[model samples]
Target chain A: MIDTIGFDGDDTLWHNESLFSMTQERFRALLAHAADPDDLDRRLLDAERANLKVYGYGIKGFVLSMIESAISVTDGRVPARDLQSLIDFGKAMLEHPVELLPDIADVVEALSHRYRLILITKGDLFDQESKIARSGLAGRFDAVEIVSEKDSASYRRVLERHSVAPDRFVMVGNSVRSDILPVLAIGGHAVHIPYAITWAHEEAEPPDEHYRRIDSVLDLPPLLAAW
Target chain B: MIDTIGFDGDDTLWHNESLFSMTQERFRALLAHAADPDDLDRRLLDAERANLKVYGYGIKGFVLSMIESAISVTDGRVPARDLQSLIDFGKAMLEHPVELLPDIADVVEALSHRYRLILITKGDLFDQESKIARSGLAGRFDAVEIVSEKDSASYRRVLERHSVAPDRFVMVGNSVRSDILPVLAIGGHAVHIPYAITWAHEEAEPPDEHYRRIDSVLDLPPLLAAW
Candidate 1:
């Protein structure tokens, strides 16, 4: 029986990818002289793939890649007149603020009674903490963790910290990687809540057994209530 | 002077609150005997306030609160027959899928060439990553961070990791707390991208000095280009 529940942040609880899409379109228009949107995307993807190790995950790295892609695709011909626009674009992205997924608070409130909840997240600590505080749901968690990465090891640590046995804990989130895969690796049950937009860097192979996929976080309470 | 950019996820990227509104309507129907929709909402909010420490952020917690509220409002007289429907509602939430904010990807690509791009996000790793991957903009970012929270410390780490000075960085998002306040705290610039539905959890005190606010992310490129 599941007694404790762990959740993923980002798309599971709020909106995320659409912002990137907006930025991507703007980038394509700026580079129209050098390449088509498809071509620009391919080049940008290539750059991101090459830089993942150095940049890790987040906007700082992506902005750099956009710069790098512009330089590479344009063969250094992207006019200086447009260079500041690129920088301005990066600045624009940085200034973007956060918004939550629909009905997230309502759902969280509904689920709190039955489960010992833990928020298992990965990212820069300061940013994570600020979001938690702002999220208003911060007060609901028994524990909140900010990790550099989400892997099998991380999942084990979280379970250990909560004294939760794999069979008694269920991981609920949107990613097949950080949420489903890692928990499953530790013999924990997992529920996959697929999101609309997925970051390339966070992509992983499909889930195996011990992992169940869902469309939203609201589904967990009923599943657990029965368990 | 900013050379890099970041974006917040959630309402900024898609349609979210409407789903919760829909679910609330359904839930109110189930508990029509207990209280009116507004009363139910108020009670749920009260319960949410009380349980924030136990459930943390997201739909899992909200659903729990809804269940709790249902039980409370009904004075524990919630019909057993209706219990199944409540559970089904929770399940339905889980099955609900993500739908991207309109024109998001194209805009991001358009802006990518003119700026250094990054996706600065806070939440569960899997959920955030899933949204990024599914959004088809996975290849666009130089970095993708699934942060635990958003605060000054998180922003500092992001800056340090990228070896970029705060003066050269800019933050973009829809939340005043996570995206705007923290960036400003660190002497970095920020732009407030407001969305239609702001999660109560992510809402913060209104605008103050040291920040700029905008109606949408679409206005960013032009605004920044002029900057």
Candidate 2:
């Protein structure tokens, strides 16, 4: 039986990738004078992938990458006003309200009563804290950890700190790379609930037949009930 | 006697503010034709102050603010190449090597043998982790905490999570606002080693007589010995 459960904060609990998608649309339009939408999208993705090491993850990095890509694609011809608009885009995203996934609140509420819930998210500490506070779901989780990366080592570290054995812990999230395989590698159960939108960087190969899969977090309680 | 000790990461343990100072100098020189040095500095500070809420703290936010300030100061006439330079400045800072303060390594080593050492820093989680790992002092600390803010409540929460009592804990750092005041307010001991450079936002009134003050971490050993 799972005594402790971990939840991914971004797409799992609330709308996150949609914000990036919408902003990417704005970003592409802003630079349309210099590059086509397809070209701009490819360039932006390249910048993000290249910058993930130095900038890590979050809206701040995304904005910086956008500016970098705009300059490179435009051959340093991107206007300063356009750059300013990019910065404004980042601010708007940071201030955007948190929107919960379908029935996630009720799912989390029901699960909280049965297991020790931890909000394990990987991103900018300040941004993640802001979202958790605004989500109105902060009180449900026993602990919230905003980490730089979600990997086997990080998962092990967090689990050890929380005095949770891998055997008794289960992770639930959207990204297979971050939420599923790492936990499974560490001997913990993982519940895969794929979101409609997935960032390219977060994409991973399918996990072996070891972990459970669900259509939505709404289906989580019943799945666990059977366990 | 202090059984557990916490150390702040940035200026207390390494050279941090100097980086910002150097970058600000370059920024002013780059925008010399647009605004006077004094005016540019003031504008940049204002932008940073205004952006703290949305952007939080880190090189990423600082870069965004610099771009904002550059555009505002230049009245949107700042060249695209210059804006690209600003983005490059941030990437350079993020990749810059960690420079430890005078004898901080030795000081941490000495204290680690006697007390449980915790490196409690407030900043971007990824940046802080990189600095800590690069500082070669991560192994010396029993635990590390990268938090969003350092206040009384944050201090209390950290202490409770570590199973530490306030009376037996002591926090050592450079910033009076972040490292000293909040720890004292939480009923714990604090040792203040003032850094040469202080950010305007971090400036707080003189802390009360309850806390200990030292000129450097070099002086920390003797001060703790007498206590």
Interface RMSD (Å) of candidate 2: 0.7
Give the clashing pairs for model 2.
none
TM-score of 2: 0.97
For each candidate, the alpha-carbon lDDT, in order, equals 0.70, 0.90
User: What is the two-chain DockQ of model 1?
Assistant: 0.03
Model 2, B32-146: lDDT tens digits are 9988999999999899999999988999999999999999998998888998899889889989999999999898999899999999999899899998999999999999998
**Tens digits of lDDT, candidate 1, A1-227:** 78888878767765556766888899999989879999999999998897664345655446656766876787766653354455456546544566778777887887776678888766534445656767788877776866668899878866775578998888888878678877887888888887877666765556475666666666666767765
Error of 2 at A165 (Å): 0.6
- Candidate that would win on lDDT: 2
TM-score of chain A of each: 0.86, 0.95
Per-residue lDDT of A127 in model 2: 96
Poorest 10 consecutive residues of model 2 chain A by lDDT? A201-210
Candidate by candidate, in order, the iRMS in Å equals 23.3, 0.7
